[model samples]
Target: MDDKTRVPSEITPDQWTWNVKVDPPFHKKHFNANLVKYHDRVMGQDKLRVFVPLCGKTLDMIYLSERGHGVVGLEFSQIAIEDFFAENDLTYDSEKLDGKPFVRYAARENNITIYQGDLFDLSSEVCGDFDASWDRGSFVAINVSTRAKYGRLMSNLIKPSGKILMELYQYDLAKCTGPPHYAEEKDLVENFTEFQVRMLSEFVVVDSPPYYSGDDFQLGVALLSH
Candidate 1:
């Protein structure tokens, strides 16, 4: 997805870039382990339904399900959702809403649903309110102007006292103009006020297998509790 056309609010669907490709080629086994590590540290509980906003074919959803949490993931692109299931060798049943389709899959015997639709249209009635949110690319994908609205919608989609694990980049503005925006500490604290911010940790691990390659990007993790 190109940075400019991905802005849903500004452009019409036809004008935007819906050309989503398969996610970065990575081993599922390694991806699952990384997700499990994060879940164990941030989620801390089992059997809780997790909401993945703007999930974009991340294998983290599958990892969340394998760990016993039912996963509800939202993606605007159908190609990405299809690619995710196809690469994982998972079978799914699909449903349509006003002509748009969503796919439902079982994640290691746990229910995992991937909705290919507008995030704003997903309601409690459809996916059910989530216990916590596992946000990887969602927050940083939007511009600063839209981050607050994103946070508010996230708070509404999740149950009270919900937890949110957001991934952001800490970089100089000169280097990255970001779809993956570089968020500052103050921006996260103030924007996510509904949730009590506890840890804003910076992790600089050597490019690990499956998730990342050589030192291409520096990342930050924001763990929040609502």
Candidate 2:
């Protein structure tokens, strides 16, 4: 489908709950290399607080915590958050957020917390501003219609000097439908007008998922700063 005629995903929170049960390939058991490589540059310190949007059961959270960073994750599925703690063998305490359809889980011994709810509902009031942010697949995974809102929320969540390390994908949208949508450099710049956007790396990915299997999927990592 052409970009103009493309249908946006109508995926609900329930659908994401089911997706986690089946174990998707995008779910990795280890740290994402891009996140590890850029952590120091983007976050700068070991004691910083990092915000992660649409954070599934990514091991990147654990990786960040191991390095002494306080990690806050926003997710929609309770299953995903539960699985994260279970898989990582961490014990946690849960509490409901007042006046919100969400729960917060805090790991007993780690500086890691995950809030379960629609990411759009997040605000600085809900969670204080962060020092840094990470977007591994979130920009591409969310429906295109919400991309601007996503960017705006991220901007609000971070401090003025905070950096965002984002991983995105680019491909011919006409050839595939996606939870992983095509995100161009222009899209990033347009949504994050307050920040200086820089494409840190780009490469053709050979082993993409079924939706983009035959296409030349260009994976990119961008660093955004104020």
Candidate 3:
């Protein structure tokens, strides 16, 4: 996760990074070109519902919704979710869930609803099943031990025919502090057995704000399908 910066041991990196830092590796000022192109290729112009987990106000939601897709995202941090609406200069209407204290933020201009709550607590009853899901930093951000649980949640959220485009990084663990953890093909297959993991492409980040002593790392983009 871009939020996984090396900081003092006392503070939680994920929440603290969002509170003060805006330059995380995956937080881009503009819509990600890779996402736009990928969506065009597989999803086309259909007004499909797209799920984004651990979504940190990626401008991609605005891009997708403007293209007529319904965008739904889950973010665990209230501050991060609030910052997203504020930073984008987007006016939104928020409503609390039935009995829970959590709120869901909806954009005024597009079909985008972002739920500020835990990923595990989110139900299909709220966001519903998606036609596809975008997992930029989500998989890698989760704890290694919980990959199976994450996989199960996704399997239930995505329709049988739905696809997922996710990002994974491969780095020497000895040299890096991971939350944007290093993952291998076997790990994905072993944990997410319900889906077929097909490696789409790979690229190297030329410049990154390294949290560790390593210079650069490779990012693998994979398509998960049933």
The prediction achieving the highest lDDT against the true structure is 2
Which of 1 and 3 is the better model by lDDT?
3
Tens-digit lDDT track of model 2 for 114-155: 999988888988889998888997887877878788788878
User: Model 1 over residues 80-168: C-alpha lDDT tens digits?
Assistant: 77777777777777767554344444344347788877766667766778888887767776656776877788777778877888766
Residues 84-186 of candidate 3 have per-residue lDDT tens digits of: 7887778899999888745899988668889987787777777789999888888888777678998999888999989888878876556666677777677
Better of 2 and 3 by lDDT: 2
Q: Which ten residues in a row have the lowest lDDT in candidate 1?
A: 7-16
Error of 2 at 101 (Å): 2.2
Better of 1 and 2 by lDDT: 2
Q: Which runs of model 3 end up more than 4 angstroms from their true locations?
A: 1-16, 20-25, 203-205
Highest TM-score, which number? 2
The TM-score-based order of candidates, best leading, equals 2, 3, 1
Q: Which of 1 and 2 is the better model by TM-score?
A: 2
What's model 3's overall lDDT? 0.77
Off by over 4 Å in 1: 1-29, 32-34, 98-110, 203-217
Q: List the residue pairs that clash in candidate 2.
A: none
Cα deviation of 210, candidate 1, in Å: 16
Error of 3 at 174 (Å): 0.8
Q: What is the lDDT of residue 197 in candidate 1?
A: 75
